[model samples]
Target: MDTKRIFRDFNHCKFLVFTCLLPAELFVSLYLDSVINWSLWLVLLPIWTLKVLVIAGALVGTIVWCHKPFRRNEADGFTDFKAMLITVGIQVLLLLFELLLCNKIESNSPISWILVFTPMYLVSTLSIGACIWGYKNARSTELESLISLNTLLFVFVSLKLHNVIHWNWSVIFIPLWIIMCLPTIVVLHHLWTLAFLRSNFHGVDKQSLVLDTIMWIAIDVPLLTFEILLASRLDQQNDISWVNIFIPLHISLLGLIWSTFGRKGGNTWWFGLREDFCTIFLRICPFMRLYGNVECKEREGGDGSEIMMMPVVTQVVCKSPSKCEPVVAVTHIATPD
Candidate 1:
């Protein structure tokens, strides 16, 4: 397979890289906000330096992973222009707001207010514009992805602006955290489904609509549970009751539903037991690797008969017009079946 050609598929690679980096970025931000006291930066220069270094490393890693080696033609023209404009506009607003919050200039002054408020206005406008673009160009998934990123960024900035004005940590942080998690969860779901479908269906197996339904539930139930749990925990200092009692019960119920209906094979279920099994295996295989062995294999006969064999394994493969890309194919042979 041509690595360059594979990389040229910017939509797939970009989304994957974005999904991976977002979690890391959120964690780093959390550390910076919670652990590092901004006032002590002068006294604890070394600690501040180390924190900056860590953040820099994460930023570099994200860039390396997500950066396209060769720019796609689709990425050029108006898309590039629009993305650049939005990014630049965001930065400008960020700077202005930071200045206002720090009280570098008197708030009573018209200039200060304008500086503080300009970014908020721009972000809102850009968000609406991006949404319109997304609606108009629904066919271009790449464009849609770009719009999604921009919209999310706008939300982040808007939340930040709210924080600056209200000066309430709980109100500000909780909403911001939820906003960040939204994109993270969506991206994860897409990647998970992409992987699951590629491995199970080979190409688009429209006939196996049942399998697709199972795949969705299998991926979503656990993911939604984990997300709710995580968000609840983050907001625990504000309200522990939800995280401690209701959330856990909700997760248990979701798990039970998934285990019962998710595994049952039929058009009633949307996808089959085989896919549910694959989804469950995919979810747990990483932790399982710490203990023992698992394997999955597909054997093809000349007569178009195919056999999928497993020894506790999970795999996802993407098929293109010219080539089939193995996204995740982990195998272990303890006693070959």
Candidate 2:
């Protein structure tokens, strides 16, 4: 089975599921409550387990990259590996903690995340606080801090929504999903940018989006699943049993699994995805490429930073001494290429 293509489809599927699921799930619960409850856990296990295995693999990769001998083979030999280790550590820890906090112990696992919720919340908030402090003085803006803060904020909003708004929240949903999508899109870009970085550092012809697939499924699936489960009428009375909602989502996800990754083809379906929608959402997702590509090979007298000059035209009001039409200044701003 082609796992990578599955990863790519799932990435797009997230937005699809996000857009439709709220209304779809709610509609299912209220009218077709019987179908909603029909052996749902039995069905979700496969994808849920698949998502966990993906994380386990990433953790394994983290350990391997951390090894001195393994690091020697990488692009920077040691420097890049060391930096990636820290990134992986932060990402993995926060992801697991968020999932743990989201899942109720009485429902599934024996360990009660409620006991640790306060601490986990404290850690997420404090990390964002520290990142904010670091961002103010740092020469470069930290993407990690901003992305993490966005996720943390979304989580807070998700939890609040779970408590207050269940099935019948159509009146406020227009603004709600808009607010929710902002963070989701930001995090999505973070993952996309990381894949771009990996492609540059590894010197691969195509970027391996598995890292993003893993991150999205592992982190987002659980978080979203919790909310979906919260809104369902599992315990309420029901009649007819129907097919699992996850089956179609998983099947649609599985059907798209191919080994290929990233933008491909003469058409716009880069990495086997719709270009128009991705452009609308992912146009701002260019962190690693913001300053052009990261070159692993060193040049004789070349500095690391790549400079890009773009002509920026701005309109300015004329001074009183020279009362005239607004002056247009076309200046070339030297920014990171």
Candidate 3:
């Protein structure tokens, strides 16, 4: 009903920019790739095809951002459902077309291309599926907050699942399937944050959902990385050692991350750290800030006389036992005047 807010929330004109890019990219890929035929379309056309996937992702992202429910913070969760379903349906058709093309090419085509492109294809496809499951019938996405910040990162890495499969390790699919499924954990994490924010969370749910997320991610990263790396080595015809140096090194680094972020009665757990020089190494360094250190700050405007200071994620050090302050809440983000 509020068209202005909808456009504003979706960021007027931005969607057009991305949507416009698709045609331009298509023109270039089609015309420049020496015509559009089954050869280029059905087979993996290398970077050109990858670029198309990127474009598809961008287009999907654009649609997601502009979905009316997302713009209005509606909880129906059905906002982009139909669109995403159609997108996925189309991908399925393409997969069928690809299979036909495969048979046309060779009996035992190297399966690497199929493995490589499928996950991203799903990512660019299934992203708009609305992640709903009978929660109050309908809910706004932001309210539901049913997505983890780590979803994209984890999904991207899990794309390498095909690598493990290509290694001829049939048993690896079991773990591979689990790692790929971790995005659902991210969705649950988002939903968990929403419950915590809305005061809807109880002890049972917290331990069940939050603890589950922490455990799954804690296990997934190391396992997937080791598998992918081992597979890559095998692919490269290099000898793999039982004592994989990378596994321990990665574990140590992530262990440090968990210690800092997981226990999180700290600033880093709230506002993330920026990759600044020397300041991280020297804690006392003056004016050190993470990138979003001072983001979405609240302010009194219209009078145009306020002197707003640079927003920084200041440390909330609890110097006294009895004076513990609460972590910053999402409600703290300022609304427009």
Candidate that would win on TM-score: 1
State which candidate, 1 or 2, has the greater TM-score.
1
lDDT of 3 by residue, 39-97 (tens): 43333444334345534654554565454333334332234343334343444544554
- Give candidate 3's TM-score: 0.23
Task: Give TM-scores for every candidate, taking all chains together and pairing residue i with residue i.
Answer: 0.34, 0.33, 0.23
Quick one: best lDDT, which candidate?
A: 1
List candidate 2 segments past 4 Å from native: 1-55, 62-70, 77-149, 152-260, 263-337
lDDT of each: 0.40, 0.40, 0.40
What are the RMSD figures for all models against the true structure? Answer: 14.4, 19.8, 22.9
Candidate 2 Cα RMSD (Å): 19.8
Q: Which 10-residue window in model 1 sums to the lowest lDDT?
A: 266-275
Local error of candidate 2 at residue 226 (angstroms): 15
Model 1: per-residue Cα lDDT over 1-337, one tens digit each? 1222122222322232334333333333444445433432233333334334434434443343345333223323235334433444444454455445445332344454445555555655665565676457432233233434454444544455445454333444444455446545755666566566654565564433544445545545555554455455555544443323333334433433433332222110111111223234334444433222223445554575544443442233122334433444344333334
Candidates 1 and 3 compared: the better one by lDDT is 1
For residue 176, what is the lDDT in candidate 3?
A: 54
Sorting all predicted structures by TM-score, with the top scorer first, yields 1, 2, 3
Q: Report backbone clashes per prediction.
A: 5, 7, 7
List ranges where model 3 is wrong by over 4 Å.
1-84, 87-94, 97-206, 234-337
**Backbone clashes, candidate 3:** 7
